[model samples]
Target: MSLLESWDRGEHTAETLRGTTATYATYRKGSGPGVVVIHEIPGLTPDVIAFGEEVVAAGFTVVMPHLFGRPEAGLSPLAVAGAMRQVCVSREFTKLATGETSPVAGWLRSLARELHTELGGPGVGALGMCFTGGFALAMMVDESVAAPVLCQPSVPFVPGRRRGADLNLSPADLGVVRERAAAGCQVLGLQYAGDPLTGTRFDTLAGEIGDAFLRVDLPGRRHSTVTTHRQQEAVDRVLAFFTERLS
Candidate 1:
């Protein structure tokens, strides 16, 4: 189905989550364990919302926060450029900084905590794509985040080899994430092998998280795994991952 068709079928409630640093407008739906769906650079567009609906249909409560861009805006080159500009200049996001977590990740952790506390599950799940992809891994610093999925995590912009190997996580945060992985917290990452935006960070993930990092590398340069590129196998794998980790 088209993204618009799937979006229309989703019955999501609009709500606001107040974080210490930012207040996020969010779309929420479904029941059971909570899964925070962080949008790509172009904001919560139709494709992103459709992906959220898929998560809801999978038996988990899905909360999609509007980190940037207009909610329900359909994909367009102009819209994407506009959102990309905003993300590039936004103080909340550390766009070109290596080994540093975006400031927004803390707010996301708060949202996840609240969701898991209210939803009453063993832990919460998180899925982030594109610019927001590494945010899921950053949230893993907290024990409440059980299932963290990263799709084409492109951040710290990959200007050089050092940044390419960086996970967009601060040294302290990276330590916590490593510890969590060592404790058996699994992380799932998806990307196209030829996508430059993803850089060599998946290799970094493999090295840092060891066997706990599950890599879903598709062939070619497709950037968006669950949305723009629309890989059915990746989607199935994510659903299965969430079911295994959160259910």
Candidate 2:
């Protein structure tokens, strides 16, 4: 049997997307406004796929890229740990930088642009979860990304006071983000009220983007507001946001 055969691809068609730095297999499904669902660490677990289907059913084309790990692996502790190790060493990810965005965001932007070009809408939406959560924010630098949703954005290894609030963006990039928000691109953020993994970045985002950063704080200390923890309210709000923005 093929190594990839064991993985359930569901209704998504396997394709390839290339950018300046990286190229990866993309599983695309649905037809309408495009939404790029970037998987978190541990790769595209079943949890993420289920959520992507949620978006697809809500009337948006969803493309999930297999960034690392087995495309369809169990969401075991070992799987998460293994993916975390890979992310820690991967050149595409910026795990501990205070003022820079991850390199993978570039490729994500390219994907969003390609989707927008194909669909011919105002723009496409980009939703990043957990480890890739802040990536949606970085993808906002591009004009092709109209709707950016960040779920429990944990990045720059926010342990200290400085990194805790870092936006995982360079000064210039942060400025561009601010400018984009000023020009009317609203950024949606979802997370728990007390998620330590998310640090103080929400406060930082509020301070940086002002009212343009729509904050949706769910109750509890859990991470993964949309996937692992699976908040219904958060999920509803996400679909609504896509409807209002992408639809």
Candidate 3:
């Protein structure tokens, strides 16, 4: 069996879930307070879905928003890689399909509200990874986001061959989110040992963000290992973090 299969069968239960597909294919599963999950560079693959389910098993509704609502819905990593290129290279394309005015982020906020209402009013928890790591923070800018877990968040230092360059939140937006954090919201981050992309930047962000930031470093773990390779530990840490912060 694959690694994801093992994690699912042992740690999490699978359930069919749905969310608004207005601009993108959003999906959700499990129960209790909601948890919004954003995908990595490869889009909404089985790995991402499994991660959502893991959170769901921890007693939170998990929502995985399909940012790339096109044909690249977790078929091949290569295809999603191409889509990543398009996101950076073709601004007009992204603007046309998703809009320049923070389309996906807006959609996420709407979904968070949906969870708040659907699950009876406790604001949703958001967990973003790799390409969508900063998405948790972006979701917070709107105020409905109470708890955010960024597992190896990517895209902040998007200059070169970074881990998650697809995340493109503006600095001004960051400032607004930081202001929210100062007002008492909590943002949690988890990363591995040697991921150059998430480690250095994660530290810098934790330092700059101050009390609102909760950083968890897996000493010998790598980038993907945080959630992919080290499945049980990651899920445990995620559940604890969300429970402590969200519950």
- Give each model a TM-score: 0.91, 0.91, 0.74
Report, for all candidates in order, the number of backbone clashes.
Answer: 0, 0, 0
| RMSD in order of candidates | 3.7, 3.8, 7.1
Across residues 1-247, which tens digit of lDDT does each residue of candidate 3 receive?
A: 4423322221112111123234455565677887878777666566666666677777887776665524224546676777677566632222212112233566677777767777754477888876567667678876777888777765544335442333344566677767988888888877776676763656556665787787777776477544455556667877887787667
Candidate 1: which stretches are off by over 4 Å? 1-20
- Sort by TM-score, best first: 2, 1, 3
Q: lDDT for each of the candidates?
A: 0.85, 0.85, 0.63
lDDT of 2 by residue, 97-162 (tens): 899888777777778888899998889999998888999999999999999999988887768888
State the displacement of the C-alpha of residue 63, model 2, in Å, after optimal TM-score superposition.
0.6
Candidate 2: lDDT of 119? Answer: 98
Q: Identify the runs in model 3 with alpha carbons over 4 angstroms from their true place.
A: 1-22, 69-77, 89-103, 156-168
Model 3: lowest-lDDT 10 consecutive positions = 8-17
Clashing pairs in 3: none
